[model samples]
Target: MKLLLVDDEPVALRFLSGVLAGRARTETAPDGASAVAAFARALDQGEPFDAVILDIMMPGMDGIEAARRIRALERGRGREGACRLLMLSCLDDAEHQIISQYDAGADGYLTKPVDSADLLAALANLDLPENPLDGAE
Candidate 1:
């Protein structure tokens, strides 16, 4: 599994990268623009990941818009969208309001300061029928 992680904080990036070491092939983007660009690069490079971990708040487009664009790409590809999205947010009750309001194309929403075990569990649960917007294979 290749992971495209988009976060603005260097510390958060380091922590996540370290924890994800044995789980998947991890690639990162520090902001929204790079997230989209990196997504394209991964597709073009023929090394698309199984999932994406995106930060909800960031400079230049934010995670919602980026996800929308990725959905568009998935549509254009004429197949089930492959990359599951895990949204990371700092907003209170983010899973309810913040994620509910936006069609950010996420497989799941996780609040900030997430633990390592929870993160791994989220990834493991990505295969659930209700989770993968595009039905899992």
Candidate 2:
């Protein structure tokens, strides 16, 4: 799958990249503004991401606002809901933001220190084709 992974923390980005290694083609952004620009560029290039995993807390814009803008961009391009969005937050209180995340266009929400299994499971539930962990029993 074509995926965009956004996080301000280098370690978190690397960890996520490692987890999805070989399972997807991923592009990384260090902050929300860059993420939005990349998303727009991908759409313009006719190669929009299939999914975007965004960290909710960032230096600027924040993932929630970024998601709102992404949704608007998709609508502007007549491709609303074409990309699935998953939100991540280091905040333990993030559970309270779940409803807001959904309202902003998130397909899923995962707390920080996210496990590889949980991430994969969430993606699987999104109906992504051939989830690598799907039959790993």
Candidate 3:
């Protein structure tokens, strides 16, 4: 799978990338605008990501707005079976936040300080293909 990981924190981004490295090919963005640009470029290249792991609290365009724009872009392109969006946030998993995430087109949500198990579980919940590296060392 091809994945896009977006986060403002270098440490968090590195950790997440390390965790997912064997499982998927990943590209990253440090903030929301870059995330959107990368997404568009992937689409243009005809090699769109299978999923986008977006951080919620980035400066400027937040994950919510980025998700909305991504969904809009997919719609504009008439893209069916578009990439899944999973939101990562340090914020509490409050009802309103969850609802807003879904409303903005997130397929799943996970709280920060994420573990590999939880991250894998979240990805499993999406309509993704089986990971080839599932049992690799």
As a TM-score, model 3 comes out at 0.90
Candidate closer to the true structure by lDDT (higher is better), 2 or 3: 2
RMSD of each: 4.8, 1.9, 2.2
Candidate that scores best on lDDT:
2
For each candidate, what TM-score against the reference?
A: 0.84, 0.90, 0.90
lDDT per model, in order? 0.76, 0.87, 0.84
Candidate 1 structure quality by residue, lDDT tens digits, 1-137: 67888999988899889987865678989988888888877777776667888888888888878887777776776634687888888765845445524576688887889887778777777883333222212
Clashing pairs counted in every model = 0, 0, 0
Candidate with more favorable, higher lDDT: 1 or 3: 3
Q: After superposition, how far is residue 60 of candidate 2 from its true place, in Å?
A: 1.0
lDDT of 3: 0.84
Could you give candidate 2's per-residue lDDT for residues 1-137 as a string of tens digits? Answer: 88899999999999999988988899999998999999999999999998899998999888988899999999999999989898898776755366546668898888888998888888767765545645432
